[model samples]
Target: MPTASVKLAVIIVSYCNVDDVDRCLKSLGRSDWDHFEVFICENGGEAAYGKLLTALVGADRTLQRASDGASALDRPHKRLASVTKCRFQNSAIVVRLGLATENLGYGGGVNAWLEPLLGVLGWDSVLVLNPDTEVERRSLSELIAKSAEGFGMVGGSLVFDSAPDKIINYGLHWSRTTGRVIAIGRNAPVGSAPSSDDLARIDAISGACVLATRSFVEDVGLMAEDYFLYMEDLDWGRRRGKYRIGFASKALIRHVGGTTIGSAVAPEKRSHLSIYLSARNSILFARRFAGWRWICHFGVGLLFAARYVLKGSLSAGRIALAGLLDGAKGKTGRPDVAPRPH
Candidate 1:
C-alpha cells in the first residue's frame, strides 16, 4: 500500500471533558492531513457524548449517527455506548463518538472505544491520543512518515502547553530497579533534538501520543489494562516482541496532561486516584518484570509515598501508602477509596 494511502485511525479517549475535546478538535482545523478517522469515547458516561457530538458537528448542522459499535465492545463489563459520526470543524477530519455506559479507566476506555474496529480493514495505523492535548498541524503526518520507516510504534515530541517552548519529554525512561519513570528530555529547550544517549535510555513512549501499526497491535495485543491508568505505556513497551520504537521529533505536541483521575499538575494537589494508581502500579509493574529486584523496587516506592507525607499532603500520603500495600497484596482494579479534594 502507498504509505500516503494508508488509512489512519486517530483515537481519543475522553472523560467528560467536553471543553478539552472541543479545543483538541479545534487544533486540527489547520491540519491538511486527510484519509484519517477520529474515534472517541466519552468514558465519563455523563452524556458528554451529546456535548462532544454538538462540538464536532456544530449545533446548526446535523450529521447522521453512525452505529458506534460500543454495544459489542467486549470486556467483562460488556459496555454499551451511543456512537455518533460527524465532520470536524472547518476540516475534512471525520469523527466517531462512543458514549460509554460506564467509566472505563484510560487503558480500558481505549480498548472499549477501538476494540470493535481492531480487526477491521479500514485502517493500517492507529494513533492513540489523550483528549487533553492539541496536535500540531504536521504532527500526525510526521508520525505517519516515521512509522513507514518500519517502526512498529512511534511517539511524537511532546511539550508542555503551559510553556510551549519547554519539552515535556521526547519519550520516557522506565527503571526496572526503582520501578519509576522519568521523562527522557524533560524540561529541556524544545528545539534541541534528543542525543543518542537520551534515545538509548527511552524504554517507552508517553501514552499521551502513540502511533502503532496494525502488526504491532496484533503482535503485542491491546495495551494492558491491569494497571488501569498509570504505567500502561511502559507495560506495552516491555511486551513489544521484535518491533523497534521510533521518535518523530518534528511531530510537536502540546499536552495539558493528567486531565482524568484528577491528577493535578501541582504535586501538592495530587488526587487520591492519581497517587494511589501511580504508587500501586509501580509495584505491579516491578513484580511482572523486575524479578528478585522487586523488593528494592517496593522500598523505593515506599520512599516516594513518604515524600507526600513529608510535604504535608496527608490525603495523598495515605492514599499512596494504601496503594503500595494493596499492590503488594496482589490487589488490582480501582481502589476502595473516596475522592479527595485535589
Candidate 2:
C-alpha cells in the first residue's frame, strides 16, 4: 500500500482518568495529518466517565455500561459520528469507543481493540497510546514517515507534560546481565539528544506512545496480557529479530507519568497496585527471557525489599515479597490487595 494511502489507527486504553482522555482527544483534534482513526477502549470506569468521554468527542452513540463479569472483548462496538466534518479532515478522522465490562489492564485492553481494529477495520498501522499522553500536531506524521522507511516499530520522544523541555524517555536499554530495563534519556533535557547510532537501534520503546505496522503485529503477536501493567513492552521487544525497533526524534509526546499508579517521586504515596505489579512483572519477565540471570534479579529484588523494610515501609516490603513469590509460581493479573491511602 502507498504510504500516503495507509491509514493509521490510534488505540488508547483508559481506566478512570476522563480528564486526561479529554485532553488527549483535543490534542489529536489539532493534528495536521488527515488520514487516521482514534479508538478509545474504556476498560472499566464509572458510568459517568463514559458519558463524559462521549460528550468530549461530541459524537452521538448509545453508551452501554458494562456489568460485573463482562469481558472487555464481549462489549459491543459503539461507532460515533465524526465531530469535525471539514473537507480536508472530513469524516476521515473517525473516533470509535469500546467499553470493557471490567478493567482488562493495559495489555488486555489494547488487545481487545487490536483484534477488531486490524481484523475488521483493516487499518494498515496501529499506534498504541496511553490515555495520559498528548501528541504534538506533527507527531503522528513523523511516526508514519519513519515507519515507511522499513522500521516495523517506531517510538516517539516522550517528555514530561509538566516540564515540556525535559525528556521522560526516548526508548529503553535492556541489560541482560542485570535483568534490568532502563529508560534512555530519562530526566535529561530534550536538547541533549542521543547519538544517531543509539536512536537507530533501540532495545525497546515505551508503550506510552508507539506505532507498529500490521505485519509486525501479525509476526510478533499482541502485548502479553499476563502482565496487567508493567514490563509487557520489554517482553514484546525480546521478540525483535528481523524487524528493527527505532526512536523517532521528531515525533514528540508529553506524558503525565504515573497518573493511574500515583507519582514515582513519592514512594509513600504510590499505590500498592503499582508496587506489586512492578515487582511481580520484573521477576516474571526476567525468568521468561533472562533464564539463569533471573537469579541476579532476585538478589537485587531482595536488597530492595530489605531497604523498604529497614526504612519502616513494612507494607511496601511485604507487597514486594508477595509479588516475588507469586511471580515465581507463574501467577498473573491483578492482585487482591486492599487500596492504600495515597
Q: Highest lDDT among the candidates is held by which one? A: 1
Model 2 reaches what TM-score against the true structure? 0.86
Clashing pairs in 1: none
Per-residue lDDT of model 1, residues 1-342, tens digit only:
236688888878887788788777666555556778877778776557667666556545333334334423222234545656666544455677777777677778788756666746668888888988899898888888889999988997799988999989888888876777989988988777678888778887889999999888888988887787888888887888798889888888899987766775577687788888888888888888888787898899778878887988877888888888888877877566655555
All-Cα superposition RMSD per candidate? 3.1, 5.4
- Runs in model 2 with CA error above 4 Å? 1-3, 45-49, 54-92
Query: For residues 1-342, what per-residue lDDT tens digits would candidate 2 score against the true structure?
Result: 235688888888877777777788778878877688777777655574446555554334222222232323234643211112111123445566666656778888888778655555447788999989999998888888888889888887799888998888878877777766788888877646667776654677889998998889889998898889988787777786678876677788999878866645566446787777877888899889888888888778777777778877888888888887788788888678654543
On the 0 to 100 scale, the lDDT of residue 272 in model 1 is 81
